[model samples]
Target: MSKQLVVYISATGTTRRVAQNLAKAIDADLAEIVPAPPFTAQDIDWTDPTSRASRQHADRAMRPPISASPSVDGYDEIFVGYPLWWDTAPREVRTWLESHDFTGKTITTFATSSSSTRGALGEQLHDSAPDAHWVNGRRFAANASEAELKAWADSIA
Candidate 1:
């Protein structure tokens, strides 16, 4: 069996739950992309256009901190998970992708969002990691059931 690693970053824990479910279903290793300091609830305020969160995203794009570093050479398949932000992935995810070498690895992306579809984000991921075997992307509800997540994982497997 090919070794798999599910690496994810979640703010409110929604994406984290989905990652956990997928990891369990695939019997893969679980790794978290933790920010160095972590984001407070206030740091995620999307409602305020002028807030630090919005301004940083607007100007610098994704600026999340990465606490753990990944060496993708060992994993045959990597499942990268995050929440869709501003119709794209969080900047931290981009940073994570840039930080590693995924030369010949298969990458599968999954996201959780309240409104945005997965199309735009998937395209962006493909653009970011052109060398990676970018599989399709899946969008799950904020509170998706474990069975639903497991079924999705099985289908992908």
Candidate 2:
């Protein structure tokens, strides 16, 4: 059985790359946090205020619907990853977390960012899965290497 699970949401494939590398490094299961309708390029355009991504970021209470929640029954460690949007995770991640029961699991977060750090993600996402144990999360560059990802995973473990 896989002890670790790596789940991520990547609108433009950046975070998906990181999550895939991390899962391979740790020999974990992988899952994608897919949006119900799936995002188009125009919907994720950061420069457009009317974009779906922009509207979700502007409203803190928003929880964008996910197509399906991943099952977390046997994993001891769960890694949640996403692209850093407005210094936090996309709201769809929150919806994914809220959909699962992670009372005894260790929840760790990671993000892909161009320049911003993954700021206070555990604190920001606490209410969604308040019962799980959360560890400090890291932000990585788009081209972060396999060695770097393994090292980070070792340190966190």
Candidate 3:
């Protein structure tokens, strides 16, 4: 079996739950992309235009440092997951990808959104990671089932 890793950042556990299910179904290692200082409830207020998330989203240069990374040397396939914020993965995802060298790996992103579409996020991240071989990504609902996640993993793997 190919060694795989499921890496994700969960703002409020939506992406975390999906990542956990996908990892179990595919027998892959699990890792979370965490913010250095952590995010508070107020910091994640997307509704407020003045919130931390809002400000950071508006600025394309905000690549906050990631505090955690699992042993990725053994994994050939990487599954990147996050909830869609402003139709894109958070900048922390870019921070993590840039920090690691995914030169010879296959990367596929699985994202969730309540109202917005994935909106070319996989392609948008191409600039951040030029060497990675990116596959087409899939979008899921915030409450997607384990079977739904497993099916996508199986098809992609």
lDDT of 2 by residue, 90-136 (tens): 89989999888999899999988888885635568878989899998
**Clash pairs for candidate 2:** none
Can you write out model 1's per-residue Cα lDDT over 7-124, one digit (the tens) per residue?
Answer: 8988889899888888887788888887767867876788988753576668754555688866676898898988876666677787788878788888888888888875423667
lDDT (10s digit) by residue, model 3, range 13-101 = 88898889888888888999998777678877899988768977899889987788554677789989887777788888888888878
Alpha-carbon lDDT, every model: 0.78, 0.87, 0.81
Q: What is the lDDT of residue 76 in candidate 2?
A: 88
TM-score of each: 0.86, 0.94, 0.92
Better of 2 and 3 by TM-score: 2
**Prediction 2 global C-alpha lDDT:** 0.87
lDDT winner among the candidates?
2
